[model samples]
Target: MRETRTMRPRAAPNRLIAAAGLLTATMTTVATAQLLPGVPASPREKGPDELARMSLLPERVGIPVGGSAWVLVRLAIEPKWHVYWRNPGDSGVPVELKWTLPAGISAGEIRWPRPEVFRTPYEITYGYADEVGLLVELKASEEIGTGARSASIRGDWMICKEMCLIGGADRTFEIEVSGAVEADATDSDRVPITDSEAFAAIARWQAQVPVAPPEKMKLRQMVEFPNGFRADANENAGVLRLSGPAGRFSEVRFLPDATPGTTYPEGGPVEGRVASGRFEVEVPISVRPGDALGEALRAAGIVCLGNARTDPAFEIEVPIGPPTAGGSTAP
Candidate 1:
C-alpha cells in the first residue's frame, strides 16, 4: 500500500488554461442569453457532447429473459485527454453512473479495466487514455415476462489533458427479452458472447481486469521488523521482498486497491529488482500511527507483470501481521 495524502490541483499550461477559460466564458454567455426575456434557449443535446464519445452498448443478440448479460459503458476519449479509474489515485475523479432500470431488472457493480499510470509535474493519476469499456452485468428477475425492456444510464466524468473539464451524457439502451429462466446460474456460469465484434472488444478489455494471483506469485514469505516490513534485513517502510521465476516477467509492479489511511508512491514502477529468473524488491507499505490497526492488516492489490497489453495482471490479498519480538516472517 502507498501513502495517502491529499493532493491539490496543479496549474495547467497557459495555453490550455486559456482555452478552458474561454470555453467556460462562452458557455456562460449562452446560458445568460437563454435567460433573456424573449430569447429561445437551444435544445439540449443527448449523449456525449464533449472531448469524449460515450455510448451504452448491449450484446448484439440483446438481453435474455431470466438470464444476465453484459452492458458496456464505452468511452472513446479524444486524443491527449484521459479519464480516471474507480480510484483515481492521487488526483482526479472517478466515473459516476446512475442507472434507470425496469422494476424487475437490476445492475451489478462496474467492472473496471486495469488503469495506466499518468504523471505530471504536479501530481500522478491512474486512468485510461484513448478508449475504455466499463462492463456492468444486467439480470432480469425470474418472473419478468418476455418483451422489450428499456434501460438508461446517466453518466458523469472528468476528462483531463493540460487542464480538466467535466462531461456527461444520458444514454438509453433497449433489449428484447426471450427464453425461459435457467435452472441455475452459478457464480462460475458464463454466457458466451455471440456478437463477433462486441465479443472481441469485450475480450480485449477483460484481459486487463486482474484476477487472483497464482499460488506461485503470492508473497507467501516475508520478513518484518520493529520499524516496518521488508523482504530482507533492510529497514524500509512498507517494503516486501519476493524471489520468483523472473523469466516469466519482464517487469513487476503493484497497483493497490483504495485502502483508507494508505497511499502509494507517484508514477508507475513499484521499486524492485529482477535478475537471472529470480527477483527481489522491497515494496513500500505505509501505515499511519494511531490509526486502528486490526489483528492483521490485509493488503489487497493487483500485481501486474510485463506490459499492459501482453501479460496478465494478478490480484493478491495478503495479511500482514504485527511484528513479534525480534521480528518474524509473515505468512
Candidate 2:
C-alpha cells in the first residue's frame, strides 16, 4: 500500500470562480454561526464538551448467536457546530472511537455517512453539522457462552464552529446473548430489536454510507504530469471520468480519502457537471517522488451525487496510470 493521499476536485468554471464560490460558502457559514445564540466567541471561550454530545444506539437487544449486530455512535452537535469526517480535509480532527467488549466479541470499522463540505477563507473541511450516526458492527463468536454482557465505548472528537473544542463521552450498556434459534422460531424465541424509531434512524444513516459504485455506472481515472513529473515540486495532477444512467443525476463530485504522502493542490480545472449522462472532474494531486508512484499512486474517495450532503454517495478506488500516449480527453 502507498501513503495516504488528499483527493479534492477542482470545482467548475475556473480557479477564480471556484474560489469565489468557496468564499461565498465560507461567508454563509460564518453568518449562520453568528446568528446562532450561545455560540462561543473564541476557541477557548467554552468548555471542551459544551458544543457536542455523544451517545450509542445498538440496533438489536442481542448479538444473535453466531451473528452480528450494528451499533451507532451518534453525535448531537450544537447549532452551527460540526464534527469532522474520516478525511477532515484542510484542518480538523476526525471522531475517534474506542470500544471495550467481552472476549469473542469484535467491532468492525465505522461506517461513515457522506459528509458536508465546509469552506473557510484558507481551507476546506468535510464534516457533519447538527447530528450524525456512525455505524459499527459487533460480531459474537459461535462458541461463546449465552448470557448478558456489558459493552462500553468512548467517542472523542473536535467540534467546531467559528473555533473548535475537543470533546469526548463514554457510554456503557448491556446486551443479551441468546442461543441460536430456528428459522421458524416464533417472535418470542428471537432477541428483539430496538424501538421502531431508533431502528429506522439507524437504517437512514446506513443508507448514507458510501458503498461500491454499481456496475452500470462506469468510473475511470488517469494521471497527467503537465511539467513532466516534477518530483521536487510535488506537481502531479489527474482526471476522472464517470458515466451514469441517463438523467439519473445532474452533477457529481469527488472527495478523496486522506493519504499520508499526497496533497491536492488548488487552482486546478473543474469538470464535474453532468453532460449527456457523463460526469468528469480534474483532481489536482501532489506526490512526493522517491516516496511512491506508478500503480501505487492510487486514489480512493467518495463520489457524491448532487450538491446536497445527504444525497446518494458511492465509494471508489482507482489506479493512477500514466496518460496513454494518445489518450482521449473528456469533452
Residue-level lDDT of model 1, residues 1-331, one tens digit each, is 0111012111122333233233321111011011233534456522224467776654222444556777778888887889998778777999887888888788898888878888888877888899988888878765666666666777778888876767777776565454442344342123434344555676677777776656875444343444644333322355444445556776876666665434445565474566776556455666443342333344555666676543766565555555656554455
Cα deviation at 193, candidate 1, in Å, is 4.2
> Model 2: which residue pairs collide?
4-259, 4-260, 5-259
Q: RMSD to native for every prediction? A: 14.7, 14.8
Off by over 4 Å in 2: 1-46, 181-192, 221-237, 267-271, 289-297, 320-331
On a 0 to 1 TM-score scale, where does candidate 1 land against the true structure?
0.69
After superposition, which runs of candidate 1 have C-alpha atoms over 4 Å from their true positions? Answer: 1-48, 59-61, 181-194, 215-247, 266-268, 278-281, 289-297, 319-331
Tens digit of lDDT per residue, candidate 2, span 198-267? 4677788988898876776665555555545444545454444444543477877778787544556552
Best of the candidates, TM-score: 2
**Cα lDDT listed for each candidate:** 0.60, 0.64
Local error of candidate 2 at 66, Å? 1.9
* Location of the lowest summed lDDT over 10 successive residues in candidate 1: 25-34
Clashes of 1: 11
